[model samples]
Target: MPTTDTTTTDALAQVVAQRFTDTPLRVGTRTSPMALWQAGHVADLLAKRVPGLRTELVGIETTADNWPGDLAELGGKGLFTKEIDRGLMAGQVDVAVHCMKDVPGDVPLPPGTAFGAYLTRDDVHDVALFPAASPIRRLEDLPQGAKVATSSVRRRAQLHQYRPDLRIERIRGNVNSRLRKLDEGTDGFEAMILARAGLGRIGEAGQRPYQLLPMEHQGKKVAVLPAVGSGVIGLQARTADAPVMALLDELSDPDTAACVTAERVMLHMLLGHCNSPIAGHCVRTPDGREFHLRGMVFNRDGSRFVHAAAWHKDPATAGSLVAADLLRQGARDLINATKN
Candidate 1:
């Protein structure tokens, strides 16, 4: 937790709680179970803080909602966010909730909109899940030439670097859908790689065999670090949308936001789009003013890579500059190659 004087911002929540004692708040989220789950979490938080403040969940369709297929082809993270952003700008929704990872570093949140609060982060590691019958218990424990499934090019590329002998395959749908592929046996994936945050959020963290892979960022292991914006949930509203902002300010986690902002700055500097095989994570000191970052980029074939790090007293600029350094040293080359 961040110290009060350094990064905490609860003033907004206090004002909103005082003002909206008699009105209901309308929040917007996607129709997916996970999206609804996030909205419910926000509603619960607001309900506890503001007595008798009614909250309603407004379901909106996104690119992912209408077209659920190979996310890689349709674009991965952004597909879930664009529609909700459109809704927010159109005044159809008061607040938009999102997985911070899915919100790009270069977010164009209309002119008057901003992300008010971010939830406390969860576990930020990659997990490898195997069939209940499989003997594999870790990344290194897999047999030679084992098949692994993942929809992320970043995961596939990294897997090749560490487990070149294993075959990487693409699997789609939500977490449960991908898990079913292994049980059904048609996918033939011996194991699958998924974000630890998602699993922890949904309470399935212990069901899988997780080997914390070392992500190349500075010199430390990756388990303690997190990808840009990993594990945090963002709540956005117009800057002038005082009611929504107040509710968000009350629920916002400053430590998580500062860390995520720094991480995202790195992503933005590297021009790391959703399609790229790049990952980064940021962490803040207990005081909440100092920040450290680790950024990684891999070749599409996963044969080559680069890792870099930097520190900042102010997260906003420090994170982006660290990422810029990585980009200058062949990160851009890898991204350009993917385009070609």
Candidate 2:
């Protein structure tokens, strides 16, 4: 009755002990503060999940990080991710961390690479940052024809749709640089649009004065139809790295993965790129039984647009349905118009 399977117990212990060796997992990431924060977060997650695991960060400066001109002229959002992808394929890094929105949906991922996990989604709302001395507290308080700075085409188009009179100017650089430009009144930037999650990650959300812009004309409601994969951090690794993939699988958030997958499906169906004035978002219902997807396609100027929303028990199905509805309303024409 007291006989114990000591042999099986010892074997299991050995397997667990060898799972993580002394070799540190190298994580590749961009060199920006926000990017480093994201990589550190992933490392921390992995360490917490496996007590003995070690992670070392490899900072890689990306083309997008250095390019000052239009992102469209230099390809697209992939510029932000391609270098890190190369690190993964070349075996320089065991893992690559990327801001999911910066990943292009218009083309397939680099060959031999795959995403192992999508972290839990963060705040998807867009916020407006004003100069510390500015009197404006809300977007509505800004005078007509006021200058607003942002680097996102989607944000530009949506701002035009919401307030056509406001002048949108292109601003580039990391989060801190842009904020400095805004604070210093560079190029007469009265306000700037930024993602809420980014500011929070850099400890600038509540510490700095900002307003959460409304998605639609809903009075006083804080919301925004965010870009596809806006607030998710994706873990990418070589397809053949079974051990790393297994570790990453443990960090995947099911709900976040479902929502981001639906959003990406819609973006792919729409053939969206960095310059495409497209937006999509998905969320699980309160009861967690269905996925609700909202998709929008807009011309560069935002004078014309199409919107569609749908719900389904399946995330991909919900995305496809919404994409179909948008296409039926001439979404493809809008997307093409933006490209031209």
Clashing pairs in 2: none
Clash count for each candidate, listed in order shown: 1, 0
Residue 242 of model 2: what lDDT? 73
Task: Supply candidate 1's per-residue lDDT for 123.
Answer: 73
Candidate 2 local lDDT, residue 38: 93
Clash count for candidate 1 is 1
In model 1, the Cα lDDT at residue 256 comes to 79
Q: For residue 70, what is the lDDT in candidate 2?
A: 94
Q: Give candidate 1's whole-model lDDT.
A: 0.74
- Lowest summed lDDT window (length 10), candidate 1: 217-226
Best by lDDT: 2
Error of 1 at 304 (Å): 1.7
